[model samples]
Target: MKKTKSYKFKEVDLVSLRELALKVKNQTGFRLRYGGLLTILRTNVEEKLVHTLVQFYDPSFRCFTFQDFQLVPTLEAYSYLLDSPIAEKTPFTGPGTSLTPLYLLERSNLKTTCQDTLEDILALLIYGLILFPNLDNFVDMNAIEIFHSKNPVPTLLADTYHAIHDRTLKGRGYIFCCVPLLYRWFISHLPSSFHDNSENWSYSQRIMALTPNEVVWLTPAAQCNGHFC
Candidate 1:
């Protein structure tokens, strides 16, 4: 008997990203105070590394336009992983245990080719957001608190100085904290599946709706180098 060819399944998430985009778009200009929403988006001690990476891109991201960030790819990728079962648990706090989400993403690689591709997509979305402008206040500020901070212009210039060349800079403290906050925030607002059974939602729903606000804040900066400053 002839051996059978294996089949691979590929999926993408569009709805989820759109929903998330809408939320981001709705950000009232009320959050437009001094430091503003953009500041939070740019907060990072290692700004130099962040800027260098962003500058290498094709069109070169503008700090303002929402579409310039290229969110579609990430949305498509994240949707694929959203509902899969956690086959194993790896505690992430130390050298021996690989518990971070990135490490876990590696594990998914052995299980499916799509896993690696999905991870890449998610990373790209994060990259665009980080490169967006005046994100310092967006880093640690509340969706509402974004309007209360100060010095967005100076903060942006300072960050640009930091982001120009190094590849070693990681993420800001707030960036790491923000990921979970965004996750939790996503859970609170999304449908029940986002917590218990995310598989049923449309690919777009999963991708867009689950975008944590904190993730929006930290992802761009996180991608600048390798660490979450």
Candidate 2:
């Protein structure tokens, strides 16, 4: 996609269609596989506690709840949190750091779940790569962007998927993503209300040093109270 000094909001769907896809990190997708205690995470003390009302998108059952997954939202964030939070335990990166959708998901406690989502992500990648080659630049890693350009879409997707899947299964490194870049693509092509929720994504883009993408996921991460049914 072409970048302009300004973006057109009239063509954007910031509030409804793309919020879920744009806001919530890939962790929501991981819980679908593990179905265990999940920690509803927030970046700061000012954030809300979300354990109820809002639901997560599970690839298997679709939109499951805390009890359904047995998640444990932190009574408090980080220092205020209990147990060894893997999401926060990232040695390679920090909590609020923005990464590829795949990287965000890979940091999840549910590695297998993240791996499963990888296949779907690859599907999305193929679609984006074929129709919108610019999506390649927004990916989390150099190899992935290169992967999109290596061959025709159908063969490229297949070859890349198998190779990455094998690496993941064998505990090897694989491609990742950057969230803000993804948001740019979403805003330009897809219907997104990113402008409606700009404040929530402050620190997420800190390390990436890229333009801010639309975000509404901060509501649950930064506003909602945790609920266990």
Best by TM-score: 1
Query: Per-residue alpha-carbon lDDT of model 2 for 13-62, expressed as tens digits?
Result: 12221322343356545444321112211111111111111112122332
Off by over 4 Å in 2: 1-5, 8-86, 91-229
lDDT of 2: 0.28
TM-score of model 2 (CA atoms): 0.19
lDDT of 1 by residue, 1-229 (tens): 2221222111122233233333343244323311122223333323322222233222233231121232211221121212112223331121121123333234434445353344332233222233222232221222112112221222223233333212113321222112211222222223444435436664333434444342243333334434331
